[model samples]
Target: MHRTWAIIGGGNGGQAMAGHLALLGERVRLFDVFSDTVNAISRQGGIKVTGAVNGFGPLEFATTDMGQAMEGADVVMIVLPSIYHEEMGRNCIEHLRDGQIVFLHPEASCGALAFKKLLVEAGNTADVTIGAANTLLYSTRIITPGTVDIFGVKHSLYMAALPASRGTRLEEAIGSVFPNFTLCPNVLYTSISNNNAMMHPAPTLLNVARIEAGQDYFYYTEGITPSIGAFVEQMDDERIALGEAYGFIMKTLRKSYFDMYNSGDMSESDSLSALCKKVVAYREIKAQKTLRTRYVLEDVPYSLVALQSLAKIAGVSTPCIDAVVQLAHGMLHGELDEGRTCEALGIAGMTKADLLRYVS
Candidate 1:
């Protein structure tokens, strides 16, 4: 089955996905708001991918025009940060056609719901199915303009669609592009299963001084010390508890790491810190140089705050999660309150059962 892809965003993940698909002999078009990024790839005529998946993936074109990018795409892959989900949704509403599938590479939390809400609010009745993966398929970073380095590819990850009923349809449509995606119960499970919400913010917040001082270090190996990892474990527990409250049991951070990486040397008894240190993919990743990086700004607001909102609706307490949110808010000068919440996601007044039924 051949498919044409429209890849939105020109970041590391976007370039990697577009390049990988193009390398697989699929027709791919890359879209980015930044003209510089588009022109860079346009000049190169393709993305050069090295490391795990190495090849020069020639693109049909790279453009800033949304309509042109999506003109004939079967699958629209949004590979931006979660903060831009709403903005992208707005940009896509006027252009989306019936039967088009809009998938968020990593939705962070409630991304599909938020996107669907935007579409309904705009009164655009396109029969588009929104889906989300719990995380990106590749652990990759950009080496230069029009070039990316893939550190590792996840063995598997959970993916699901909004309205729950479209799960199978989404799988059938997206299977060729992401064969490793395992369909879960619904968007709630996929959102709740977001491991970044548990792993990123805690260690980043705990190591604020180093980041503020502009020191360099390995983010996972050195930043996540034993004490910091213990704090992250508490946050992960709250995430799992929130899932349980919503009738979904998610894997712990440690278990998720093992599942995604499939590292043979990982043990069931390894602590979170030990497990993180063992992951080869994370070894070369460096810590953020400043506090404004996505580790704190993006993850804190989009991921942690969203989780806190879900916990509120499910009547689940998340003290550890709350602590991080508060610390981030204070440190970042209260810039994170407008993140994805029940009201923002259009489920402000719904009960847990109502919310579950809505997705189901």
Candidate 2:
């Protein structure tokens, strides 16, 4: 059967996904509330993809109506910012029909868990399955209102359904679309294995002065120096420790990047600078034009803070992660600690065993 896919964001990832699915001949209905992206797609007749994914992906329909978008859809892929997951989940709950799957593309560190809680609190009774992708399948950007530039496609992506039981069916459905994705134990592995938490924040934070100075440099190639690489490795240690505490084996940034991009030989001693030089893809990725990029605002709050929140409960002291989170708030000039925490995710009071059962 040709399953219907309703992509619920019009951002870069959403556009790229719509293009990929439509290119593969899947029925697609894309929706966005704020941006004119869906509207632009309707006007343009299709969403165009350049660079790596080349083709026009037809949208069977595009809309801002939440209900209309979800009508008869098999899978609803929520590809929005982590902070908006709850609100989006709430909006989709009532309209989502039975047996529908809500897959968060790149859960940005346990976004699916928070979204699941929102679904429950919203009194959702439908037999809907919820799952998450550890990271997006592509490095993409909206080249224009109705076009996306896909730089690269991930070779391996992690996904898992909540409660662990719904994974196999969800895996088959998604795998039919994207065979690159593989199932993990659960969303905990998906969340903690998010490489963005390892790769994004520190490089941008360390390059804040350059971003402010309007330096014309490609972020990965020119920004991620040896010093930054060493710092990121330590940051990875904090994440790995936090995961180990919970009995999940998190992928190191080296292994994660290698699996995703497949161009770097990141050995134990290979610095970020060396890995950057080896990966040809990094050269095209430019630094953020401004200091207020998602690298800090999004990553710090949703990624690092979420990690530290779990780390605290797991009795792991994350000095490097904590320092970066503190530095990011200071640099961004706001209290970002109000991001998705254990308390916010309804896991603050649970013991380790209880937490395992809750997610399991």
| Top candidate, metric TM-score | 1
Q: Candidate 2 at 1: error in angstroms?
A: 2.1
Alpha-carbon runs more than 4 Å astray in model 1: 259-266
Residues 1-360 of candidate 1 have per-residue lDDT tens digits of 778889999999999999999898899999999999999999999999999999999999999999999987888989999988888879978989988889988998888888888988999998888889988998899999799999878778889988788887787877756788999999889888988888788888889989878789899999999999999998889888999998887889888777755568888888888888988878988888877778778888788877877888888999999999888888888666478878888889888888889888
Candidate 2 error regions (>4 Å): 258-268, 335-337
Model 2, poorest ten-residue lDDT window? 259-268
At residue 217, what lDDT does model 2 achieve? Answer: 86
Error of 2 at 223 (Å): 1.7
TM-score of 1: 0.95
lDDT of each: 0.87, 0.83
In lDDT terms, which candidate is top?
Answer: 1
What's the true lDDT of residue 329 in model 1?
Answer: 84
